[model samples]
Target: MTYRIGYIVGSLSSVSINRRLAGALVALAPDTLEFFEIGIADLPLYNRDLDGDYPEVARRFKGDVESADGLLIVSPEYNRSMPGALKNAIDWGSRPWGTNSFARKPTALLGTSSGSIGTAVMQAAMRNVLSFLNVPQLSSPEAYITFKPDEWDGDMVTNESTRAFLTHYMAEFAAFVERVLAHAPGHIGDEG
Candidate 1:
């Protein structure tokens, strides 16, 4: 059975390394998993006024999150926290209060930074937010990445050791997703 996985890019820039990592992970997806890129950049900020008259963009964003069996967020840390754009996207989806798109969905976080901390701290911040959203995240073999700006290209995960780690991370993430879907209420196979 195929699972629809939404890969969210936290940064909007065309050259964003975080986005590139998400794309690379998608490329590694097996035939049973279909990866969809969730366009977070194009969304407008959350507004109660707009909620009643939902824009096409908002509807699509909500649909993507709602339809996916799980989510993969390639977060980029900004000032040691999750980027505003990424946080905003989640805020939008977690609304019309109590009917969050992410409710009960499985999510995995992977992040990269030019600094030594990678995205460890941001993940901590996100853990709080995820708790509020009631989203179930993969809990083992936590995925994290750090890279030196001088050593890598925009799209290629060229650091050999980092690449190997990320490859292993993706495989584990896929299995975690399968396990999550297997047990979620009413989530059975492709129907998820």
Candidate 2:
């Protein structure tokens, strides 16, 4: 069965290295996983006042999150933290009290950066937030890629080692999603 995987690239910049990494990861993913981007560029800075009546864009974003079988967040580190736009999207997805779109979803986080540490700091911060949101995240094979221009050709990771690692990561993610979904409440496989 094909799984609908929604991915969020945390950079708004057109030339974001994280975006390229996300695309390459998608290309390396298993055939059963179909990926779609969940755009965060247009989401306004989340305000509690808007919670009572969420904007159309925010509603659409929530719908996308709820519809996905799993989620992938690819982010870049900015000043030792995740980009503000990505945080904003997270806030929106977890808001409107009791309507968190991310709750119980099988999620995976990975990122790329020019720094030697890659996006470690950013992914750590995201892990805390996602934990609070009750997201079931893939905890193994943590991917923190350091971007090397020579190793990449546009949206493809040209280096054999990097490509192999990403391929394994995607396969793990696909298995994680299926495992989570099989046991989810109301899933066909569930005993109840």
Candidate 3:
């Protein structure tokens, strides 16, 4: 019952706290989910002029979006909005007009930040984008973490409450993915 999930992160810094938070989730994700991080750092800034003949990277990224059953977005607040790289990835996946790869794909938003805001505003912006693509998103059990540097010892999320919270959150997201797959055309796990 494993679901393939396309993953994206909002930060590009070499020592991004957002990346570490995503790593923690990866280490904690359940067996029912298989994550594949799609690197957006290599993508050129999205431009409509290139839509007619998308770059190799753009085509590959679209293919990645199409093949996955769902998406898991990990973000950090950047000046009260989503990072440009992540926004560019979304734009690339949404285009060439009426061929959005994300339409109807189940998605969830999880984010962390040192500030109290915790990417709430950024996720809101993403919500509007995904809504336009007709993608389904998880709205319950929100993750808006204010990260602490001392909260881990490599990969593991050491805080007991945070670990417990994420364990349940993953289970909830797994259920959401199942519901989405059941509703999708040519649902993957269906048996005729």
TM-scores for all candidates: the values are 0.89, 0.95, 0.93
Residues 78-131 of candidate 2: C-alpha lDDT, one tens digit per residue: 888889999999899887887888888899998999898989998898899898
Ranking according to TM-score, highest score first: 2, 3, 1
For 1-192, candidate 3 gives per-residue lDDT tens digits of 889988888788888777888787776778999999988889999999998999999999988888888888898867878888898998998888867888878888889888887788888888887787788899998988888779877766799999899888888888999997887753232111
Which whole-number lDDT from 0 to 100 does residue 101 have in model 2?
A: 85
Model 1 misplacement above 4 A: 149-154, 185-192
lDDT by residue for model 1 (50-167), tens: 7677788888898888888889999888888899999989888876665678887888987887777779989989988988777888777676776566656666666777677667
What lDDT does each candidate get? 0.79, 0.90, 0.83
Inter-residue clash pairs, candidate 1 = none
How much is 46 displaced in model 2, in angstroms? 0.8
lDDT of 1 at 49: 79
- Give one clash count per candidate, in the order shown: 0, 0, 0
